[model samples]
Target: TGLTPWLAWVRGQAPPRRDFNPCGAYRFVRHPVYLSFMGLVWFTPTMTLDQAVLTGVWTVYLFVGSWLKDRRLEHFIGEPYREYERRVPGYPLMLVGPLATKRT
Candidate 1:
Protein backbone atom coordinates (compact mmCIF):
# COMPACT_ATOMS: atom_id res chain seq x y z
CA THR A 1 0.00 0.00 0.00
CA GLY A 2 1.06 3.59 -0.70
CA LEU A 3 0.14 6.97 0.71
CA THR A 4 -0.59 9.68 -1.80
CA PRO A 5 -0.17 12.59 0.55
CA TRP A 6 2.82 11.05 2.27
CA LEU A 7 4.38 10.32 -1.09
CA ALA A 8 3.70 13.90 -2.03
CA TRP A 9 5.56 14.88 1.09
CA VAL A 10 8.40 12.64 0.01
CA ARG A 11 8.34 14.45 -3.33
CA GLY A 12 8.36 17.68 -1.29
CA GLN A 13 4.97 19.00 -2.35
CA ALA A 14 3.25 19.14 1.01
CA PRO A 15 4.51 20.19 4.41
CA PRO A 16 4.47 16.72 5.90
CA ARG A 17 2.65 13.45 6.19
CA ARG A 18 -0.07 13.27 8.82
CA ASP A 19 -1.76 10.01 7.90
CA PHE A 20 -1.42 6.83 5.95
CA ASN A 21 -2.66 6.51 2.36
CA PRO A 22 -4.38 9.85 2.67
CA CYS A 23 -6.07 9.68 -0.74
CA GLY A 24 -7.42 6.16 -0.12
CA ALA A 25 -7.36 3.80 -3.14
CA TYR A 26 -5.65 6.28 -5.45
CA ARG A 27 -2.26 5.13 -4.25
CA PHE A 28 -2.00 2.59 -7.05
CA VAL A 29 -1.06 5.10 -9.72
CA ARG A 30 2.65 5.94 -9.39
CA HIS A 31 3.10 9.50 -10.66
CA PRO A 32 1.67 12.97 -9.95
CA VAL A 33 -0.69 11.65 -7.35
CA TYR A 34 -2.57 14.91 -6.95
CA LEU A 35 -3.24 15.21 -10.65
CA SER A 36 -4.34 11.58 -10.75
CA PHE A 37 -6.68 12.10 -7.82
CA MET A 38 -8.20 15.19 -9.41
CA GLY A 39 -8.75 13.33 -12.65
CA LEU A 40 -10.33 10.35 -10.96
CA VAL A 41 -12.53 12.56 -8.88
CA TRP A 42 -13.71 15.00 -11.59
CA PHE A 43 -13.42 13.15 -14.88
CA THR A 44 -16.91 11.65 -15.04
CA PRO A 45 -20.49 12.90 -14.91
CA THR A 46 -19.49 16.07 -16.66
CA MET A 47 -22.20 18.70 -16.94
CA THR A 48 -21.87 19.48 -20.64
CA LEU A 49 -20.23 18.42 -23.90
CA ASP A 50 -17.62 21.10 -23.40
CA GLN A 51 -16.93 19.71 -19.95
CA ALA A 52 -16.51 16.23 -21.40
CA VAL A 53 -14.02 17.55 -23.94
CA LEU A 54 -12.19 19.29 -21.15
CA THR A 55 -12.06 16.07 -19.21
CA GLY A 56 -10.40 14.35 -22.14
CA VAL A 57 -7.87 17.14 -22.38
CA TRP A 58 -7.24 16.89 -18.66
CA THR A 59 -6.55 13.19 -18.92
CA VAL A 60 -3.99 13.89 -21.63
CA TYR A 61 -2.38 16.46 -19.38
CA LEU A 62 -2.15 13.98 -16.50
CA PHE A 63 -0.58 11.41 -18.76
CA VAL A 64 2.05 13.91 -19.90
CA GLY A 65 2.68 14.79 -16.27
CA SER A 66 3.40 11.16 -15.50
CA TRP A 67 5.74 10.89 -18.48
CA LEU A 68 7.69 13.94 -17.44
CA LYS A 69 8.00 12.50 -13.96
CA ASP A 70 9.39 9.27 -15.35
CA ARG A 71 12.00 11.22 -17.29
CA ARG A 72 13.01 13.09 -14.18
CA LEU A 73 13.17 9.90 -12.14
CA GLU A 74 15.34 8.29 -14.79
CA HIS A 75 17.69 11.24 -14.63
CA PHE A 76 17.84 11.27 -10.86
CA ILE A 77 17.73 7.63 -9.80
CA GLY A 78 19.70 6.54 -12.84
CA GLU A 79 19.72 2.90 -13.99
CA PRO A 80 17.59 1.48 -11.20
CA TYR A 81 14.52 3.59 -11.94
CA ARG A 82 15.12 3.37 -15.65
CA GLU A 83 14.95 -0.40 -15.31
CA TYR A 84 11.79 -0.01 -13.31
CA GLU A 85 10.32 2.14 -16.07
CA ARG A 86 11.29 -0.44 -18.65
CA ARG A 87 9.64 -3.16 -16.60
CA VAL A 88 6.56 -1.19 -15.68
CA PRO A 89 5.08 0.68 -18.61
CA GLY A 90 4.78 4.41 -17.86
CA TYR A 91 1.29 5.83 -17.61
CA PRO A 92 0.09 6.38 -21.20
CA LEU A 93 3.79 5.87 -22.11
CA MET A 94 3.63 7.96 -25.30
CA LEU A 95 6.92 8.98 -26.86
CA VAL A 96 6.71 12.76 -27.12
CA GLY A 97 10.32 13.91 -26.86
CA PRO A 98 13.50 13.75 -28.88
CA LEU A 99 15.08 10.40 -29.58
CA ALA A 100 18.47 9.44 -28.14
CA THR A 101 20.63 9.12 -31.22
CA LYS A 102 23.80 7.12 -31.24
CA ARG A 103 26.92 9.14 -30.53
CA THR A 104 30.61 8.74 -31.31
Candidate 2:
Protein backbone atom coordinates (compact mmCIF):
# COMPACT_ATOMS: atom_id res chain seq x y z
CA THR A 1 0.00 0.00 0.00
CA GLY A 2 2.94 2.33 -0.37
CA LEU A 3 1.81 3.69 -3.75
CA THR A 4 -1.48 3.19 -5.56
CA PRO A 5 -1.77 1.42 -8.88
CA TRP A 6 -1.71 4.81 -10.66
CA LEU A 7 1.60 5.88 -9.13
CA ALA A 8 3.21 2.45 -9.14
CA TRP A 9 2.29 1.52 -12.68
CA VAL A 10 5.30 3.48 -13.89
CA ARG A 11 7.51 0.87 -12.23
CA GLY A 12 6.29 -1.78 -14.68
CA GLN A 13 4.89 -4.21 -12.12
CA ALA A 14 2.29 -4.68 -9.43
CA PRO A 15 2.91 -2.72 -6.29
CA PRO A 16 5.33 -4.33 -3.85
CA ARG A 17 2.97 -5.93 -1.44
CA ARG A 18 3.28 -9.07 0.62
CA ASP A 19 -0.41 -9.93 0.45
CA PHE A 20 -3.91 -8.58 -0.09
CA ASN A 21 -7.08 -9.65 1.67
CA PRO A 22 -10.56 -8.19 1.98
CA CYS A 23 -11.92 -7.69 5.48
CA GLY A 24 -14.29 -5.57 7.58
CA ALA A 25 -16.33 -3.22 5.38
CA TYR A 26 -14.85 -4.83 2.27
CA ARG A 27 -16.63 -8.06 3.19
CA PHE A 28 -19.89 -6.13 2.74
CA VAL A 29 -19.24 -4.01 -0.37
CA ARG A 30 -16.47 -3.81 -2.93
CA HIS A 31 -16.41 -0.02 -2.95
CA PRO A 32 -16.79 0.97 0.67
CA VAL A 33 -14.99 4.30 0.25
CA TYR A 34 -17.23 5.41 -2.56
CA LEU A 35 -20.28 4.01 -0.81
CA SER A 36 -19.62 5.98 2.39
CA PHE A 37 -18.69 9.14 0.49
CA MET A 38 -21.86 8.93 -1.59
CA GLY A 39 -23.85 8.72 1.62
CA LEU A 40 -22.17 11.88 2.94
CA VAL A 41 -22.73 13.72 -0.33
CA TRP A 42 -26.48 13.06 -0.38
CA PHE A 43 -27.19 13.93 3.25
CA THR A 44 -27.65 17.67 2.72
CA PRO A 45 -30.38 19.12 4.95
CA THR A 46 -30.99 22.11 2.65
CA MET A 47 -31.29 20.98 -0.94
CA THR A 48 -30.73 24.27 -2.76
CA LEU A 49 -30.68 24.24 -6.57
CA ASP A 50 -26.91 24.56 -6.80
CA GLN A 51 -26.41 22.04 -3.99
CA ALA A 52 -28.72 19.59 -5.70
CA VAL A 53 -26.84 20.06 -8.95
CA LEU A 54 -23.52 19.47 -7.20
CA THR A 55 -24.87 16.44 -5.41
CA GLY A 56 -26.18 14.96 -8.64
CA VAL A 57 -22.83 15.50 -10.32
CA TRP A 58 -20.96 13.95 -7.43
CA THR A 59 -23.33 10.99 -7.40
CA VAL A 60 -22.66 10.27 -11.07
CA TYR A 61 -18.96 10.82 -10.58
CA LEU A 62 -18.83 8.43 -7.63
CA PHE A 63 -20.65 5.68 -9.52
CA VAL A 64 -18.42 5.97 -12.57
CA GLY A 65 -15.32 6.33 -10.45
CA SER A 66 -16.20 3.26 -8.41
CA TRP A 67 -16.65 1.21 -11.57
CA LEU A 68 -13.33 2.34 -12.93
CA LYS A 69 -11.66 1.65 -9.63
CA ASP A 70 -13.01 -1.89 -9.70
CA ARG A 71 -11.41 -2.49 -13.07
CA ARG A 72 -8.16 -0.90 -11.98
CA LEU A 73 -8.02 -2.86 -8.74
CA GLU A 74 -8.70 -6.09 -10.57
CA HIS A 75 -5.89 -5.36 -12.97
CA PHE A 76 -3.40 -4.47 -10.28
CA ILE A 77 -4.54 -6.66 -7.44
CA GLY A 78 -5.16 -9.61 -9.75
CA GLU A 79 -7.31 -12.67 -9.04
CA PRO A 80 -8.28 -12.08 -5.43
CA TYR A 81 -9.86 -8.76 -6.23
CA ARG A 82 -11.61 -10.32 -9.19
CA GLU A 83 -13.00 -13.01 -6.90
CA TYR A 84 -14.15 -10.33 -4.52
CA GLU A 85 -15.87 -8.50 -7.38
CA ARG A 86 -17.62 -11.69 -8.30
CA ARG A 87 -18.93 -12.03 -4.75
CA VAL A 88 -19.81 -8.37 -4.18
CA PRO A 89 -21.38 -5.33 -5.84
CA GLY A 90 -19.91 -1.87 -6.30
CA TYR A 91 -22.91 -0.59 -4.30
CA PRO A 92 -24.52 -3.36 -2.32
CA LEU A 93 -27.26 -1.14 -0.85
CA MET A 94 -28.56 -0.51 -4.38
CA LEU A 95 -27.76 -4.08 -5.44
CA VAL A 96 -25.68 -2.74 -8.32
CA GLY A 97 -23.08 -4.42 -10.58
CA PRO A 98 -22.62 -8.00 -11.78
CA LEU A 99 -22.88 -11.44 -10.19
CA ALA A 100 -23.69 -10.50 -6.58
CA THR A 101 -22.64 -13.94 -5.53
CA LYS A 102 -23.83 -15.74 -2.44
CA ARG A 103 -20.95 -16.46 -0.13
CA THR A 104 -20.67 -19.78 1.69
TM-score result, candidate 1: 0.49
lDDT of each: 0.52, 0.74
Candidate 1 lDDT by residue in tens digits, 26-100: 332345464566567475664687876776787767666766776786675676655454433333342333212
Itemize residue pairs with steric clashes in candidate 1: none
TM-score attained by model 2: 0.74
C-alpha lDDT (0 to 100) for residue 83 of candidate 2:
74
The prediction achieving the highest TM-score against the true structure is 2
Best by lDDT: 2
Please provide, for model 2 over 1-104, each residue's C-alpha lDDT reduced to its tens digit, 9 standing for 90 to 100: 55576677997776657566788998878778887887887996778999889999998888788768777887878988877776776676555344244244
